[model samples]
Target: MNAIRQRIDTEVIPTPGPNPKNPLQARHLDHRLVHDLIARPEILGRLRALVGNDLVVWASYFFTKEPGGKEIPWHQDANYWPIEPPLNLSVWMAIDEVTTENSCVRIIPGSHRRVVPHVPARDGVAFGQEADPAYVDEDAAVDMVLRPGQFFLFNERLLHQSHRNTSSRRRMGLSARYIPPFVALLDQDAPPLFPDHACVVVSGDDTFGLNRTTNPPPRTA
Candidate 1:
């Protein structure tokens, strides 16, 4: 994690968006972190058990919340990704101790099974007020508090969001997405800004290259 942080600190600049200054947004740090994390046999073994061997990282994002950071509304991660079949998984690691006072992620249990319609993420943050009426059950949502060095791995389709950071200290986290290599992107024309080599699957034989391979035939309506 230190190596990854150093890489981001040196190579990339904090991407500015609708949010205030100090809200860190860095992509492609996965290559550095994966290289470091995969070296750990125990971590690799655990990832292999979950994602199998032939996996590729789909996307990654780092969120660093400055004091008084904004709130992230409830939503599902699959709503942002362009992959088909919605089989991706996310690993969210808390770089700093996170609590309800800060910005701990809240998730709706068993919400992964439901396919929610995509609502435009507010100001590029993957959260919004609108929700799929089909899956509105108040009892299912629960808060997830993570300590520094702790992480949560869950299906990307799970309904989750982070509340505002009311604390004085900064809240930092890394969110990485993984997927099977065979899963093709639904939007071939629109590719992510960062390079794809950042992804590394701990298990499976499949490998990813710079080549852009389209699905044999696009999904039909």
Candidate 2:
């Protein structure tokens, strides 16, 4: 965990601003510590139980909200991803003690039942797109406060967002997105995915051969 924090402090938080090539956006691609976290035995076991045995980690993002950071408007992850089936299970793990004051992720209960329409986000928000305000039930939103090392799972279509950081503390969390190998990922140079993106097969076999696959990085001393 300390190593993860160090990397983010040195490589991610120091960046001038958000970019497609930002290290925090996909640290798992080159960092062994981040890669191993997504493939941890306990995490993979639970993921396998939910999605299936043959799991492919297609994306991993580090969500870091420093004090006074802007809010991420409500939006479904499916709105931004490019996959054949658009099926995904997001594992969001807290690297710091996340709380409502620090803008912990908030989700609308049962919002994954339908895909909501999105529009260009207004200025000052963290994302470029946001779910239509008419469809968001802010009154029913639930805050996901978590302790360090704790994680929660949500579907790709779930309506989730976070408020601007009001407290002095910074909130940092890692989200590892998993999908079955059968779900092909399209567009290599897209916003979320880079040109040479490689998916990691954390469990079972990826017989589908739909997307590029690679072995996990070696453990660092």
Candidate 3:
């Protein structure tokens, strides 16, 4: 966890920018450390039990919330995703001691049952769009407080969000998205996903051959 956090700290500066600035999106593509962590046998074993053996890791992100960072509005992962079947399981691993004060992720219980409507996000939020408040049940929301090395899994359509970092301590977490080979990535050369993007097959065989694939990056010095 320390090594991963060091890599994220070296790769990204918590600054406002177009994309991949503070959150450091998609590092698993080229970062050997991140790629190895996501491909660990223990993690893959759990993922296989939930979804299947064939898993393609198409996306990864470092959610680094510094002091006074903006809130990530309540939203579903599928809202901005571009994949057929829209199936994915996100493994959010904590790199820091996550707490409510530092804006640990929160999720509504059983929110993945149906897709919720979205609206333009209010001011001081991270994402442009957010789940409609009418559909969000705050009373049922639960905070996912975690220590370093801990992780949680959630479905693609699960409604989740994090509040602004009110504490002086910084909060950091990494998310790796896994999907079956049958789910096709609609576009490879696009925002969030760069040109020549290749998804890594983390487990089982890629029998479907629906998306571009690549091998794990070489270990960095």
Among the numbered candidates, top lDDT falls to 2
TM-score of each: 0.72, 0.92, 0.92
- Give per-model CA RMSD: 7.9, 2.6, 2.8
Model 3 misplacement above 4 A = 11-23
- Give the per-residue lDDT digits (tens) of candidate 3, residues 161-191: 9999999999989899999899999997786
C-alpha lDDT values of all predictions: 0.60, 0.86, 0.86
Model 2 lDDT at residue 81: 87
**In candidate 2, what are the lDDT values of residues 1-221, reduced to their tens digit?**
76777766775456532234575776676667778877888798898899789999988888988999999999999998889898999999999899999999999989999999999999999999999999999999999999888898999999999999999998999999999999998885676787767888889999899998877766761
The per-residue C-alpha lDDT of model 2 at residue 102 equals 98
**Selected candidate, larger lDDT, 2 vs 3:** 2
Clashes per candidate (backbone, < 3 Å): 3, 0, 0
Full candidate order by lDDT, most accurate first: 2, 3, 1
lDDT of 1 by residue, 1-221 (tens): 55555654454434432122322432333233333432245544556788676666545566777778887767776676677767877778776778888878888888888777755445644355435645657567777788765777788778887777879977877776667776666653444423322344445544644324221111120
Model 1 lDDT at residue 104: 85
- TM-score of candidate 3 relative to the true fold: 0.92
